[model samples]
Target: MAGPNSDPIVSATTAAQLPPGAVVLHVEAGDRQSAEAAFAAGHVEGAVLLVRDEVVTRPMRPGDGRHPLPSAEDLADALGRLGVGWDAPVVAYDRQHGDNAAHVVHLLRLLGQDARLLDGGLAAFTDPVATGPGTTPTAVAREPRPWPADMLPDIDAVAAHAAAGGVLIDARAAERFRGETEPLDPIAGHIPGAVNAFYGDNLTPDGTFRDPEELRARFAALGAGPDAVVYCGSGVTACHDLLAIERAGLGRARLYVGSWSQWCRDASRPRATGPA
Candidate 1:
């Protein structure tokens, strides 16, 4: 999965202090009322609540999985509407254990934008919370480029990786990875030769990401390196693991964007049950 070497993207370790002029993006996939209720209770100062329907995903198709990515143009439009400039340093947060926020951070990074998930999410906020609606920035119309080609691996690439004995990680729950329980997708197993590294393991009990050295040790157990490929049920939660990998300084890993949902759709693709 290792490709071109690029400059590092700076991140904020805490919610209280961010890169200057950083925009706080609060992404929650729950119902609007509850999300707004949570936002009113206290969101980072000057943070905006990005509506779930508006930016979370696009219409689902048979092979696109439950949470298909929106078009780059549509995403650019949404961000522009929210006043997120192409160069703006963004700190995204969500109450759902950083899954939603990680998704946004992943996409923004894919688009070559400076974005990072607030470590520990909203709970990590040590500053005063602001109530009511979010502040709108002076709209900036910037034409966004297409999604980076190297950001993800397609189905064929994933199969090749597995066949080549490349490191492939399943970020689903251990039970789900073992085919013991699958409450979402129809499939109950993981890709052949894929190791299970439950994304939640990257976080501490309080929900903040574990220390980088600890994370490095955990991924090292799975043989994670620059060539690793990570996936989850439908590719949303997988970003959390990818972010963890980056935070651990483990190098860039490719994402199987369609993930298990897309893989299982084609019965010809090999699927393995139980522990790898």
Candidate 2:
């Protein structure tokens, strides 16, 4: 069910839904301690743990923001150490629906690999559970490749897109987008001309993604078409909206990797508060 052009999301009520020999990754936010604890309790057979902060992002700095993208060579090497080769079909999932997994899958896709998010995440996986730091396959060799130009846009591109009347989506909580509160970053408010489309809204009450037609209608109402540019506070959760857009049949949307973290740090950039 997975190939070069398959859907970016998949559901596995049973393990059969996953492509044969697909490399399953259990993604965790921040650190590996909690992930390791969870995995020790129970996890799908052969699924390896990947801490988001450690594997996909670099240390926070003034220009790069809280979670900057890792170098292409570093990412390839990390995946190769996890036994993921160039052509492996990767299925990434996390405990928090699919937000974390979506980020990993998004990066993998940018590197020209076939990657997908496991819809419904660990809660919906019906496969047999394995405990005690499940055995990982032998490490494979992966050649490093640059991220595609069109998929990863810098702050300048996002600004130009907004000025051109393109759909610029802010995938953060409404409160954060409205400048009512600032928990993580130094700034409070979203980029001017960007519409709020919180990533969590993409999931159903059961934590699975909504139907494709439903998602299509939801995003269409927000003025997001195939050319939408999506971002979040730190450029992590925005992938949830991106995957939803692709699941909605709107094609892949570009990611603003630096996102609001980069945009808000500059005193020159204008910030807008309240609803769009």
Candidate 2 residue 171 Cα shift, in angstroms, is: 0.7
> Per-residue lDDT for 167-255 in model 1, tens only?
99999999999989889888789999999999998888988788888987988888877689999998888888887777777876778
Best by TM-score: 2
Off by over 4 Å in 2: 1-5
TM-score of 2: 0.95
lDDT of 2 by residue, 1-276 (tens): 233335788878677778888999988886678778887787777888888888899888778767898888998888888888977889998888987889999888767678899889888988777788888667999888887778788888888998888889999999999999989888899998999999999988999999988998988887775578999988899989988887887777889989898999988788999989
C-alpha RMSD (angstroms) for model 1: 3.0
Model 1: runs farther than 4 Å from truth? 1-16, 31-34
lDDT of 1 at 67: 76
